[model samples]
Target: MAASNVAAPLSSQRPLAIEARGLVKDFDGTRAVDGVDISVPEGAIYGILGPNGAGKTTTLRMLLGIIDPDAGVRRVFGHDRPHEIGRLIGYLPEERGLYPAMKSVEAIAFMGALRGLPLAEGRKRGLELLERHDLGYAAERQIRQLSKGMAQTVQLLGTLVHRPRLVVLDEPFSGLDAINQGKLEGLIRTLADDGVTVIFSTHVIHHAERLCEGVAIIAGGKVPYAGSVEAARDRIPAQVRLETRMREGAWTHALPEDARREGDFFYFSLPETGVEPLLKTLIEGEAGILSLSIERAGLHDAFVAIAGEAAARQLEADQAGGGA
Candidate 1:
């Protein structure tokens, strides 16, 4: 691991919790993260989103100072060095493991000790965190004795022992059932409620869509959109579909020229004023409305729209191939 030394950033006036400016990384001559820039607000849940091999992990590693960027600068809490921030930030990597012989409490304390916390203090804090996470009874259990979900929770407990202000979880929802995934979502929300800035990277857009206030979509080692989640969704227009028994007439003329028609159904992009007026107009008229739906664009749609369908297809292919 490369060590990060404290250095004053050129601008100390920005109040961002995490900021990366034109970050770039290369491996064996191929760029993994190319000109990526991101700004994470304080006390917000932010997500770096992509499919496998989109360089999400590489970008995060650079920001955490685990690896130096080939170009650009990264600052967390206005400091250029992660070591300078130390216990102020907690990191949970995608690959999780624990010593089979180590007790849950002991494991947590060990992680804390690496960040300069005394054993007694670390244990005290670790117990509190474990209890808070509903793992109080399992504190003394060895890693090999706990269930898979319980062991994962214990590993997460170690990440929280020092009570860092910023927590970075890489693919935190991976390898868990839907129930456990929901539990993880709640835990993330609770952490943010305590004023901690939470940054997570995930290939699953559903998780990011539900939990993140802002997100950055990375495809092919490039960021297509970075800002509020709403902004990403707004990049593509919502789709309106009208399925009526009455198909052809003045009502059909109401649809845009680009509207796609199939039998008695009409599908088109929602107008700026939205479908309400159109619905009212149809209802006032004698058009027998069987079904009408306006499907708002989701993060996944936005990813395809902004990053291009080819990139989305490639991402899916990479995910299926088990590449990251």
Candidate 2:
């Protein structure tokens, strides 16, 4: 719950995991990221959510030191730059690949070696992760023989082989089946529970709703909302819907003027006076209330509200394009 009651621009938690202040990036005079600010609390799963071309990957790369930001500051593990903090963070880029001829374990161990891990230790850790992730048998197999999902998991495992403190994934769920996505969600939760800070980028709002305690919604090269999932949802008003058998005009005065009526249900915001009095009035008026429910806005609705309807539509169109 990083943004529950933000007293300042950044998180107040001790030993902050990652921070980027007014980050901006440009290429060929076109800005991909513009004035973005983010704070990730230690030991929490944070999500960077946006539509395609929303500057998520650019911001992530800036924070990871893969590409330098044209403007602003980024801090990784209390350092101003990622140079000395390379071994402290694990990064999984959206682009996925490996040596097609290499064995799975060999690929993973090779990746760990680049992160300053010894070959024997990296192999041991890779084996442990393989067994833990139910891919022990695949360790001996070549990368070319694995399915797309399995290969993606192997890449993620390689990123995590050295057990870095902060794990940043870019579109980790892309091309994964439902089962693999669920398993990855569980793996993220496990990492947080183990005191690791995770930050991932995704266009799917539901993933952030289910897995992250904090989220940043990016749109059109800027962040419109960043904080706890609860706070983001709280940005929109709750909707009260009731289905009634009696559709007569008798209950009209009891409801708000802005209420909309559908086939069998009336939908509107609950008045400040509360639902109890409204329900009582409906009952006394002899309105047959078949069903009544109050539902808070979900992450998708909140994202649309915060990030703009255009961005949401773009995300939907992007999804359709990917599926096709």
| Winning model by lDDT | 2
Error at 61, model 2, angstroms:
0.6
The C-alpha stretches of model 1 lying farther than 4 A from their native spots are 1-14, 276-285, 317-324
TM-score of each: 0.88, 0.92
Q: How many steric clashes between backbone atoms does each model show?
A: 0, 0
Clashes of 2: 0
Q: Write the per-residue lDDT of candidate 2 for residues 1-324, one digit (tens) a residue.
A: 212222123344557788888899989999999888888888989999888988999989998988989899999888888867778888898989899988899889999998999989989999999999999999999999999999999999999999999999999988988999999999999999999999999988778899988888888888878788887777777889998878985777889877999888899987778799999989988898899999999998887777777888988887766521
Per-residue lDDT of model 1, residues 1-324, tens digit only: 111111122222426899888899999999999998888878889998888878988988899999999999999999999767787988888889889999999999998887778999999998998888788999999999999888888888888888899999988877776788888999899998998999999877788889988888887788867778887787678888888877666766676777998777888999888888888777767688999888889987877777777767876775455453
lDDT, candidates in the order shown: 0.83, 0.86
Record all residue pairs in model 1 with backbone atoms less than 3 Å apart, i.e. clashing: none
Model 2 regions more than 4 Å off: 1-14, 249-251
The stretch of ten residues in a row with the least summed lDDT in candidate 1 is 1-10
